[model samples]
Target: MEPRSHKLYHLHGFHSRNLLDTYCSSKAEMPFTYEAFMYPMEKFHNAFSSGDFRGDVLIDFSIGPQIQHLYAAQEHFRDIILLKPTEHCILEVKKWTDSRTGAFDWSHTTTLATELAGKSDQSEEKEIRLRAAIKHVVKFDLNQENLTGSIGLPQADCLVFWNILEAISKDLKEFVRNFRKFSKLLKPGGRIMHYGALNCTFYMVGGEKFHFFKYNESDFRSMLSNEGFVITHLEVSQRKAESDLMDFDSVMFCTAYKE
Candidate 1:
């Protein structure tokens, strides 16, 4: 079914707790949010440990105020350069890094990540390490020629993106153009990992509906291939529960390297 047209909202308010309740809260029947946090951490740890790619810097192009996506990155890379599309995201990411009082508690997710990586009781230390490892949190606009604005930084060894596509892009052509910008920021043969909602129209946060560019698995594969990325691994997980809060059927994650 085609999603009805409506006034799309940007994450202007970017209500942190409301977002947690929508996706991260454990009260929901389906573990969609939990799984979204888990699989990426697992894949990152496994991929790096198995000699997939390791380098000094990794650029994170994920959305929202979340940090669970960076669990394994601290161990593998010396620096994590985050690119944020909004002020709210920059503030939220820095809140956790600065140990601010109102920051969302990510301890549970951190503990789970360590356990999945074959370690126990290391969550606290892992959190500390992540804070130290993040070197830059730069504001970015996908529409700009330089996505990071005036800041000049070294090309990263890997670019990791999460849920960014369905949020900012209104269509496939725009998505393709923005994707090429990401490629330019990475070194030749650098790896890429993208985790995004599949076939989604809009997701609700703070009771506001935000329309997004909707696409499926085929579009995802073709885009990566056409953009000169060699697909190394691709996986999809069904959301597995129904809710009015969101209408996505599944999530898509893939690992690739620029060819």
Candidate 2:
């Protein structure tokens, strides 16, 4: 497998739109990012609102620069730490958090989140909340034994991972090994929100192909169980085939707790 780079993946906000537009191809067909990310977020929102999932620190392990995956849970946590794989990805996120011109617009996603929260599509309020809530954005190396490296981060009450393991791992064993290391970043009984491709081998961004761990729903559940995580919520949505993009049968969204 080739080394994963920003060139092979979508590393900016606007590039993410290509993922939704090109691969999804239709407004009716939910993209993998949307289904896998947004659905779990909606669950987290409701859980937090009802005082079901209370947490002070939330950490995000990202595949790249994208931030939409954290929209639902942003307001619930007192602090948010974004860990990106590369310095380039870190800079990409900073552009938006810093409110620079030409930042990738997340208005659409914020609008959706507002509606989910039983409000009108008030995108500005959502944006303001996200900007204020994101306290730190730092570069992290997932391949390193110390996931956060020299910059120490507290063990989070909740961990969010989206398209991270599947995109970075060369195989299942590597995925599991990295997952174990990542789980250590959370406190005991800390909740996890995981989203990934199901049975997908590869995906494209910027006209380059990148690999994904090929696994099904059963594999995902068994792995979490073996890691001592009790699965509280699991949702798998059937994927629509987009010939030009990566071919996968489903997308998996999971919420689990380390026990």
Candidate 3:
């Protein structure tokens, strides 16, 4: 069956190019230099234009197509679909809340927290607490089950799971098992892009807990190799989190082909 769409989730704030711009703009006090800003943008453009990233139907599954550069490449694809997971997740969460609670009680924060914790233990309680507050006011729930079977991506030529592995659990075995399931979602021979930070904090998605794992290049490469993927490209970038006061000196971005 022909796939209905190509889904690219969390592209708004998480796209590397967007992040680079934020990084540059935040450091505007250092020097008002257009060269510094243009350099990264050019790099991102080149990467996307390259043959490695291919899909006729592109989907932006974030808040929206917040990326300004992608507009320039609209001609390169047949269709571009933009979706907001936040909205859907919120809707699902709300439905769940209403089902559990007879009436909409905006003050019921603990119940959401309990639900998020039960979904994933690695989730940050503080983040969950904060999301619960907003969720109570919003019209939706952000649970994973709500997301299941929702993403309809075209038969992807290549699938990129960039920088997301590090945000999963540290248990390598469990991580590989989970990833294998993700890989199966791809068409045979499709490429898999894997990017990981050496050390990073767990993330909370709309009140859900997602853990982070740290690994060196060798360790991660081996994991991919064992998973039946041929390592194509590996690039390392430095990661610094001022809020968390953590610095992951090296982050690896790997391009692997499913054989």
Candidate of highest lDDT? 1
Assess candidate 1 and give its lDDT: 0.77
**Model 3 C-alpha lDDT per residue in residues 1-259, reported as the tens digit of each score:** 1111212223212332332333223343423122222322233344555666565544332221122223222324444333233454334334433345432222222233233234334324433333332222221112343323454445545444434444433457755765665565456777654444565444323223334554677777787789788887777655433333223555555667888
Better of 2 and 3 by lDDT: 2
The best-first sequence of candidates by lDDT reads: 1, 2, 3
Per-residue CA lDDT of candidate 1, range 1-259, in tens? Answer: 3344533333344665666656765554535554556666676677767677679999988767767878888888899998877787788789889999988788767877789778877888999999999988888766578887788978999999887766766788877887887779999889988888787787777767767678999998999889888999898987765677667788777899988
On residues 197-241, what C-alpha lDDT tens digit does candidate 2 reach at each position?
Answer: 688777776676676677888888888999999998788877744
Q: If scored against the real structure, what TM-score would every candidate get?
A: 0.91, 0.85, 0.50
- For model 3, what is the C-alpha lDDT against the true structure? 0.42
TM-score for candidate 2:
0.85
Cα RMSDs of all predictions? 2.3, 3.8, 16.0
Clashes of each: 0, 0, 13
Candidate lDDT (C-alpha), each: 0.77, 0.72, 0.42
Q: What is the lDDT of residue 16 in candidate 3?
A: 28
Residue pairs clashing, model 2: none
Error of 3 at 240 (Å): 6.8
